[model samples]
Target chain A: MSELFDPLLAPYDERRRAELVAAYMAVEHAAAPVPEVRFPALREPALRRTVAAMLALSGRTLVRGADRDWTSGYHDDVAAALAADPACVLPVEDRAVLTLVLVHSVAIPRATGTLGEDTWLSPYPAAADELRRRSQLPVGELEAALRRLRTAGLVTQVKAGGDEAGGYVPGPQFHRLTPGARRRLQEELILAAGPDSPLAAAIRARRRSNEEAS
Target chain B: MSDEWAPGILARARARVTGAVSVPAAEPVPPGLAAVPDGPRTWLLPSWPDGATPAVLEQYELAPMPLDRSGQARRVLAAALRCCWANLDDAPWPGVPAPVPAVLDVYAGMTRGDAALAGRWATGELRRLADTGWLVLDEARGVVRTGPRTALWPHEALGPLRDLLRRMPGPSREALGDE
Candidate 1:
């Protein structure tokens, strides 16, 4: 079974670094880091628009709701955003997984990463488990995915085995979608997503609704 | 006033605009693309190009307007603007704040301080001046220059700036800078 691991997601670590810098500035500006915030707490949870645009460049757009069914409008908007952007990296599926991981994290951002484990991680423990469960496929599909990411130079293996979150946390520098990285992702997103695909249609419909409401 | 105080004038204009527009603030802050900086202010900020409103403007400086017209004056200006803009055709709209006479063609919609713009330019009537092509908004230079058509020599062909609001859907960006 092909492995599902993605090494390319490591650049997200760089993003975390940049965000930390911004957060530190905001906290300093606010006179404090909102002491209530802790290593286990989410400092900033909203998917910033610019960051969202950046992630879109990675070939995946964050699904803005709790629903599981992906929409075409979402894909279209994500594609459009990426098309306009030159940043981001990772193939389509990897970007999708990365986006989903980040999106779901909004519900609980403190659980994984440099922030360390927190209550935020607990709520979505199921996600990691799902990855693990899927990891058992005979040919190591998950492993294969991770290999592809490594070959693309997006991920680096630090160690084997999954964490308590049941997800493999790659090295610290694999999560960001650098400018040129995104172009590669855009192509993958379109290829895996397919033109006229149901996912694309739904994304388009969602965008239409949003535009109409505005 | 010397254009050297253009810096001060820019600040004054900003304060007036901030007071005029309703900015939608949310968790993810909306993008403020134009980072026009305040003259003496430390922060390097940009004005919302063509998007300035009196409300946003109040943040910078509140210069008392030269006119004494009251609320009713707005209606007069609106009427005049409608007459002048009535004939303009729809064009590309960048969502930028173009002047009424230039592209927006609706003078009444563009307000300056408490008094309707009519008095600011010493134009006897807002509707009258705008319709005759007497208004020119120099947003970049931070000034509104009124021509002589309405006073020195009226343009007989120029009509009131009404019927032009219909063209607002897609106004050309040039109007904002087309002089």
Candidate 2:
């Protein structure tokens, strides 16, 4: 089939174009970051630029992995702007559930020094029973919300194992967030989970300074 | 950077995160969307590169979006296809709207005993399928139509689906009497 030449993709040959498209599709659609070793095309600087251009067309940004991987997700600024319009944001109940998960799975662990990384992925799964106790939502409503979150890749269920009753953790979709988005999420978690903490104060101070600088 | 294509690309990208965006009937369908045959609006189905799918995640032991009951969901989708898709030769988007009961009947037919129970299970599965865009459920109209995602099924795979659907029973004639 004769393909229309997209100026953005013209730098690459047909095979390269195919590789770029495949890599983009895999990144956007996959629940997790695609390992760079398997998709060598992502390693090429020119091809990576092409992918970024393609992503820009749609208001997305390329998520370069800290580990060897690649993915694409909403550009943080664009997403925040969109979220200002209520329709574009997650519903209030869903946000509540997500915040609970983040607090239990991420913030609490980090505060206790059990978790080392700033990434959303948490080894300390939030126990369902604990969530039930902490949540203001009714059990049925909370369960239903969790189910929706699970389906959307916002949270994943962990199976019970020796010495640990399985619960929930941040899902693969978290890996798709760009670095800016990840930092923003971390800051948001800190503010929500530890509003009075010295760390939250520091974050607020930094944000204020950055805003003044801008 | 081209001014003309920016809005279209933005619309397609937003639709990827959100659901299908509706285009005016008189307006051209955006670049990424494939127009639904004889349907009111176009639906965006991302064109995947050859031999790549969301399943690529499996190679790295990553699970795709969790489907609550995949087996039941697929069975419900097959039943929706059986009901809505009238022509074997054509692609299955914008297929004829089949009454909700009719699709449920076909689903119930797939299992032995307790048709009512099967129908209940099928109803739940139908909602889940509708939620994921595999089928469009029109509750007020009491009908179900094949959704845009069905268009993603590759042409080569349709032949096997055709054979399987052929052997699978259709909605009993008595059930269709009301429609």
Candidate 3:
């Protein structure tokens, strides 16, 4: 179904929906090391609209952070629509597992020098193990969430492991993110992870090398 | 307006654009030989030039829409509509009914602060796009879907966009698995 139609969230009462939207936004705009929401703000129409727009455009949501007390990360669609349209919004729930997935999809590529031309993909069990390390959610719950992300088109299964097991790569939506949105995300990473961070350096060196190669 | 009524209101507005004519699916192409060669001689068919397909041409025609008041509003609506279309899995494909409230959420999100005003803008834009026959709105069902025009968005037309997106850097680089 369209990301527009979220059955999991459709049945909630209006107030609860409002609260979830509010909570999602708090972490989305939070500037702390880890973003969290204390009281869901009921008065921010712009924030609400932003979330709706992001969800509408991308079918992804912001969830509470797991690695940190309160943090935010793009769950599905890998920030494609939000990156394209900076005016977008996001979701909250299954915070840690989803964050781990997002980090795995978005971050780890450069860290491992596996980005560009050939994307480094991971098997489901490997992702599950990493997610288990970061969050308190059980294996089943993490798998369920991963399934949900796949259903949402945020991540796609790839043919790997020679039929023994399949791996995953970023979904089609990941490639749809706008350059501006991608740049903004990179800036955020540079600030949080620092310009001298190994991943950042890898990314820079990759770009420099690619430019020189071309 | 209270948050309670926002969704309902958006749905009702979308219902206003309901009803559209569906076009027939495109025709299939005939199969042909890849290439042929005989005794150091070769015969080759000229390659079809890029942008020669109907879809590409149609997309090119629709590409330069000005992003003014209604223009910008219409684009936002289009994005939401695309999502509505994208989410149609197991619902008999692209003709799935879309919730107006969901489509409006996209516009409302972008406009922020004044959802009422944004709703008005969206309603007006929807009507306009509907009038152009590019979008079909089912007001009674409170859903919307792409009109016949969108069928023209050929795979080739999106090539450049896909390339650009592929080249863009991701947000982070934290390793998650041993692989």
Top TM-score: which candidate number? 2
List the candidate 1 regions with Cα displacement exceeding 4 Å. A1-132, A135-138, A151-167, A170-214, B1-179
Interface quality of candidate 2 as DockQ? 0.41
- Report the C-alpha lDDT of model 3 over B1-179, residue by residue, as the tens digit: 12232332222222211222222223221111111221243222111111123232232232211223545655554544544455322221244455666666655655557778777778757655654444657777766665544444445454554353334332111211113
Tens-place lDDT digits, model 3, residues A170-213 = 44333323334456455545544567778677778777898899
- The prediction achieving the highest lDDT against the true structure is 2
Positional deviation of residue A192's Cα in model 3 after best superposition, in angstroms: 5.6
Candidate 3 chain B minimal-lDDT segment of 10 residues: B27-36
lDDT of each residue in A27-131, candidate 2, tens digit only: 777766777787756888877777777677676778877788888887775676566756466778888988888888988898788886657889889999888
Candidate 1 lDDT by residue in tens digits, B80-155: 3333333333211111233444422333245456444443443434433333333433445443333222222113
iRMS (Å) per candidate: 23.9, 4.1, 20.1
Candidate 3, CAPRI quality class derived from DockQ: incorrect
- Cα shift from native, residue A15, model 3 (Å): 49
> Which scores higher on DockQ, 2 or 3?
2
lDDT of 1 by residue, A150-170 (tens): 333333333334553343333
lDDT minimum window of 10 residues, candidate 1 chain B: B41-50
TM-score of chain A of each: 0.28, 0.90, 0.39
Instruction: State the TM-score of candidate 1 restricted to chain B.
Output: 0.24
Give the true-structure RMSD of model 1: 26.1
